[model samples]
Target: VRAEAIITRESGGGRAFHALVSSDGRRIEADLLVLSCGVRPRTRLASDAGLRTSRGILVDDRLRSWSDPRIRAIGDVAHVADPRRYAHEREVPGGPAGLVGAGWRQAEWLAGALIAGEDPSPFAEDSPGIVLLKSRHVDLVQGGEIVPDPFAPGSGEVASWADPRHGTYVAMSTTNGVLDGFVAVGMPRAAAELSLLFQRRGELPSDRSLLLRLDAAEQPVRATGRDETVCICNAVTAGGIEDAVSDGCDTVDAVGCATRAGTGCGGCRARIAEMIDEWQGQHV
Candidate 1:
């Protein structure tokens, strides 16, 4: 429903109570609402800590605090600067992705940076954003750059398959034969398959029409390498799942129980299942 205006009050006013919209405009009604949310970047703590705070806590590409390298920031709390640049604006990274994947990537990088005592290479500034919506029988996944370089050498192609009734829209662009930008909606298998290609930055075949096919007749999006992550939440790798399958984890639930992979977020459950099938075929 496209809400043009929020009707907080009954047709006419004179109401003792009204529904409350959330930080992002979600309706919630109660006699006394205990609120704990903010749409704005919370910088009070950083300011109090004497850290330079702007739209967010300013941090270098390494995610180190501008004032103190010992302190690091990640996710929505920190504004990451472009690591490639070193100027007055060097400290100002572009807008934050504000996505879970962004934070997860930061956490993973931070873990490595702390151990190695070096900056996280290919940091979050340029990492693609993934949009996911999962439910019992519904699935949606979008990732990669939204706008591709139109004039770049060996420019990518844009393709899409949409179905409004099912609320499905899949649009993607590939540059120099690589799967780069894509938006997948209500296409679980296709989206899941395409995601791996996008993440891998893998090259597409000479005949790329199969990728845009909305039907099940479309070709598979290629297999996952053993080392690549199939489930980010549990840090489960494709090889790990293969080992589990070798020990007799046949179904998604079984694999989850064995490795605790899909128990969180459950975004990778489909991919996990796909890998299990691929593994079984190879073993057979």
Candidate 2:
């Protein structure tokens, strides 16, 4: 027997990657093939732009590159100082932690620096965040269930949810009511927020149900202070989507193709569509 793999293109794109196999005087063809892929630090552009590129673009405690005083890079494209001590020794990963919250923190610091005309210190300098991954689930936990402090060093926790049938598991280390780090499986969404809360050393909500409500909802609820990203893959916020509609991308598909808001997993597609309708109704 022989095997063949085929892949399909999205949209109205023509059929491509047709594969075939023949054995024992018979032939077999495949119309679809799926493959898992991995990602690496992409720093070529930073290098081209005259920034010092290490495993990723090396940056100072402020997330500003050493080679270029005016340039700042963030997300997976830049490497900031790692503060984790795994196995009792400081460990520096080739890439900075990759997460929507991490990027948001970086962006916020960069914006402050740009507006103030001076470099601002990295937001999560005291506590290093951790990524929790299991199968299709991922979470970032920064602080745990502690009062008076959310991210007291070693007090934060991260958990992941891979199977709804099985109870979730959370691993965390806390000290002095502060969160240090954690790895969890089966609850990434909650974990991601916990990670942020810990990094910010912000107060945890007295009612955990509020967090659950926000997480389970299909639409984003307005929260005061610090804008939350509705479409993480594109770094687009609720306000950004409103602006995009005002500037025209008047449909979910158009907004997605234009801003890549709903391109990944498509969980936010419905929300994008609703926003488009609301914008058009009010303006047009």
Candidate 3:
């Protein structure tokens, strides 16, 4: 049987096609299609509030909407600038890394800026690379590298293992003795720490042994105090959840209804449950 996931990305529209396989190892063409993607931003509230919105509500460095100083935005609802690599001199809009960590950082920056009576600086830096928790592979790229050929020579060198066996892979690249990009799969904890290391050093490790040593650490990346959005599709965040809890919405379902967390796809349901358990443990 042949099964495939076909993805089409175009300027006008995009779609994904999934092929079905029969028990007898035969491939069957599907006439009916089912799409299981995720939620997108709903900027009507920001617009209703008189905030400037394009694809999403526009926010400044402090995540303050263009219309109201008292209102700040994070997560998918906010159209924040993305960090670009040195290779690509252009800017990508709407959040950094597109992960929980990115939202958390935005939240922290906004909070600090608000408390200090200063505007937060919009994010304008590129990550060395992002780690994909699934796929068990890493993709390494650099700025100005013409987005490597997925089928050409040296592609394997740039793209590491995607083996489902060992459940680990490392893909990284360096330019002028500095790490430019990396993508690690099935190594969320390692990926998080490596991201921090890249930011702090602004350079890759020269010694292969040291690089290996760093990778061997057992610690996973922990969220920082400044993180903004924890759930992107619904725009819910740790801080937002905390605010909801403080307002007496304590259960996960309550938080979802109150702050709109875990309403999309429910991928973050486990995390929300953990938060609820922790809150109850501490309070009750």
The C-alpha TM-scores of every prediction are 0.62, 0.43, 0.46
List model 1 lDDT by residue over 168-216, tens digit each.
Answer: 7777777777888777777655665576677678776666556545335
Best by lDDT: 1
Report the Cα lDDT for candidate 3.
Answer: 0.52
Tens digits of lDDT, candidate 2, 1-284: 64443334454566565555445544444554434343567888887888766557777667767677567778777777532332233344556656554675677778898899865555563344433221232333333343333455543443222345654544444444344544444443454455555555554455543444444547343321234344544445567677677777878877876666776545556557776776667676
Predicted candidate 2: what Cα RMSD to the true structure? 11.2
RMSD of every prediction: 8.0, 11.2, 11.3
Error of 3 at 226 (Å): 18
Error of 1 at 208 (Å): 3.5
lDDT of 2: 0.55
lDDT (C-alpha, whole model) for all candidates? 0.67, 0.55, 0.52
Give me the runs in candidate 3 sitting further than 4 Å from their true place.
Answer: 1-39, 67-70, 81-98, 117-165, 187-193, 207-284
Rank candidates by TM-score, best first.
Answer: 1, 3, 2
TM-score of 3: 0.46
